[model samples]
Target: MPRERILELRHRGRSFREIARETGCGYGTVRRAYWGAGACAAATERSG
Candidate 1:
């Protein structure tokens, strides 16, 4: 759920700090979630 929310915020062009504040998570946590999602998407595209 947190990951999805992070992604949603990122898609809306929210900064990491903004996401962290809105999600009640640390900035690094939000940043990592975004990077993790991007990595997963890249892997999926490559595999598909």
Candidate 2:
């Protein structure tokens, strides 16, 4: 459920700072997840 936890934090509008604190995830990890999601969406749009 690690990915689900990340999405929940995202939906709650938690800052990367807050998510890091709450989830004990590194800042880079949280930020990477966020940006990676955006990149996936962008790639999808380009392909479509």
**What lDDT score belongs to each candidate, Candidate 1 first?**
0.62, 0.60
lDDT of 2 by residue, 3-44 (tens): 555677789887878876665556777777676542223323
Alpha carbon lDDT of residue 29, candidate 2? Answer: 70
- Residue pair clashes in candidate 2: none
Give me the overall lDDT of model 1: 0.62
- Which pairs of residues have clashing backbones in candidate 1? none
* Among all candidates shown, the one with the greatest lDDT: 1
Q: For candidate 2, what is the lDDT?
A: 0.60
Tell me, by TM-score, which candidate is best.
Answer: 1
Report the error of model 2 at residue 26, Å: 1.0
- Give, for candidate 1, the lowest lDDT window spanning 10 residues: 38-47
